[model samples]
Target: FAAAQLQADKNDVDTRLSQVAETTAAMMDDLKVRPALAEVIKQLIAAGNVVAYLPQDRAPRVYRIDQFVLKRDNYGQFTDIIIQEKVWPSTLPEAVRTALGVKLDPNTDEKQIDVYTVVEQRDGKVTHWQEIEGKEVPGSKSDPIPTDQAGWLAPRWTVVPGSDYGRSHVTEYLGDLLSMDDNYKAITQFAAIASRVVTVVNPNSSLDVAELAAAESGDYIYGEPDTIQTLGLNKSQDFAVIKDVTATIEARVKEAFLVANYRDAERVTAEEIRSQSEELENGLGGTFSVLASELQQPIAARYLYVAAQRKLIPAIPEGIRPKIVTGLAALGRAAEVNRLRTFAADAIQILTPQVFASLVNAPAFLSRLGNEHGVSSLETLLKTEDQMAQEQQQAMAQQAMQAATPAIAEAAIGAATQDPNQGT
Candidate 1:
């Protein structure tokens, strides 16, 4: 019984150890992966590769081609990273090609692709046209080749073509250009969505303050609040979603459009696709700029709020601290006029009498205070008191003239009485 129990205990220990080991390995893998996922994704996008099957007579023909860099990061990540897709209009049956306005090529079964890679120096451009042949063109004389010389290398900006590779007989099927059209649709859709999130900024004081105040009051000012840009916080999932969807679409586009014949398909261009993708990015940037402007509206509001609050709670009464009242009232009025009501509130809330004392002693505010109320100005106040005494003396002289007028009137009446007696 003791031996049996020992064996069971040993088995339990081993199980626990195994579990720990598994957990540790899983954790380490997760730790390494979580941080590197973005880097991996970027690398994959930079290294463009597309593989897709094209439609043929009553079946699907396998075609691989690379056209252009499916723009990912620049265009909110939803813009399809397009590789040029090549389809021989001749590959379809006579009836099908006639209906589709092209003939499907039977011999040219494999597709061609152009891969763009940047040169380390001079920002030079090269194109690695990967066709069915998988051979580097310019006869391996491609300059600034990646040290780990993959099948081929290309400069990022160069417009190039692919090489010929063996054609394969595959199932021919009919489908809409859905696979090709989907990436473009996805990119435009993402751009539209991003535009909605970043509204145009109409700078109006009342509206700006009201909306911000309402938002702060826990009112849902904007539906789909996720669209609103939040600074100092994680980006909205809309952005992330756009990014993710774009990457997926771009990857698929790269697959769908990649061709195996590089040199021959040079006439097929991706300039239109590339330009549209860039426009999408520019649109996103415009939207982001508008959102940024909207976000900053609060700053002005904050300043006004603090200023008003400071004025509301004056350091001294107008009579006792006339200078203080003058200065603070000016600030308060400015805050009110500027709609910086929140800033005024914050300033008042943050400042106390002790804090105010320290702030007043600061060189800038102090200089303004002294310049506002010069020592000579205070002396003028004292001199005005002396003028008050002189004004009093002038008032006494006017009273004496009034008294003499009354006595003169009485003496004239007496003289009139005496003159009447003499006349009788």
Candidate 2:
């Protein structure tokens, strides 16, 4: 069953693996998380597999293949996992030590020791946990460690598998290209050496070979008749061939990783750029789908579960599975910007009196558009129709009062001049 499941999901798994490899490679250029991301990529390239886990009080941690063992079920879902880690005795909390049933000796020197944590999951949920000391199980089977959250406190491992069984980028993609790159570098170095002038002195010539060689600025050779000749091969053609070969190899590497190449001087139109972007999106669609299903959604669910337990986020509504959206952050943002620009243009063109009059639920459509453009707060930023009406009424009332003020004063003065009481 497991073998069948592996075969069934192999294409999907490989797609996601390729995406992760490409993303990791791209992320090596990010300044904020470059160090950590570079380390993760290095491990992936070296070992072909790495594990990501979220600890209680720290950033997500990555472990190499040697640090963990994984067992997958028939559906290629992780069913059981064991992680071995070394921790200092001083780092363990007293309650945790008591729960583990280990008593530390005060006289014994504090030292690092390996702790094995085993987690078993059933039907996509963690069901059991065991902490073992060396080879001995310390705690009773029935008494599990106390956890505020229902599932394991330690987040279950998320395995990032590379291209194949031995998930390694270096092995799969860079192996041959790297060798070619080295050869190119060596050829270039030799070409540089070959460009230097060589001086040959005839035996009977009245010229000092050492002085001719020592002259820094000029190349001159003195010899009897045609005895001395400059010997240097034109390597320009050879250099061009090597350069072309190296560039082709590099371009292959970049294309494999889905990285854009800007080596050529050919001008590309906006339509071409859009077409290429769409093609890229289509190519990575499988990868995005796999990541959403296998990695992002599960990790988000775990985070929300923990948050709900701590009253950080609202409790999960019963019977409704929370929706988690995940993608490459930079790409997602660009997509959003493009979508909003398109929507704005469409809205401006369709919002004329004639078009709006023929539309149904125009208000709702506008609201939806606002939400899509991330302007759900448009109501707060702009006045409602009723509010605008009220402000217009207020402005009219003030105008009427101001317009009547001069007339009222003129009438009052005329009455004062005509009436005896007003004059007095």
Highest-lDDT candidate:
2
Q: Clash number for every model?
A: 69, 1
lDDT of 2: 0.57
Write down the TM-score of every candidate.
0.16, 0.64
Off by over 4 Å in 1: 1-383, 420-424
Model 2: per-residue Cα lDDT at residue 42? 66
Ten contiguous residues minimizing lDDT sum, candidate 2: 148-157
- Model 2: per-residue Cα lDDT over 107-189, one tens digit each: 98877778776666654345444464744344423333222222332222223443212345556666767767796787879
Model 1 lDDT tens row, 1-424: 8975665465444343333333433443543433333332232233322222111111211112334443322212112222344444444346543443443456776453333222221222222332212322223233442211211111111111332121111101012234436645765766666555334333432245456544655455543433444333234564566557656655544433332222345475665544544544453343233222221222222222322333522232234211112112233334333344344346657896566555542333322232233222322223233576798899999999898997999999888877555866
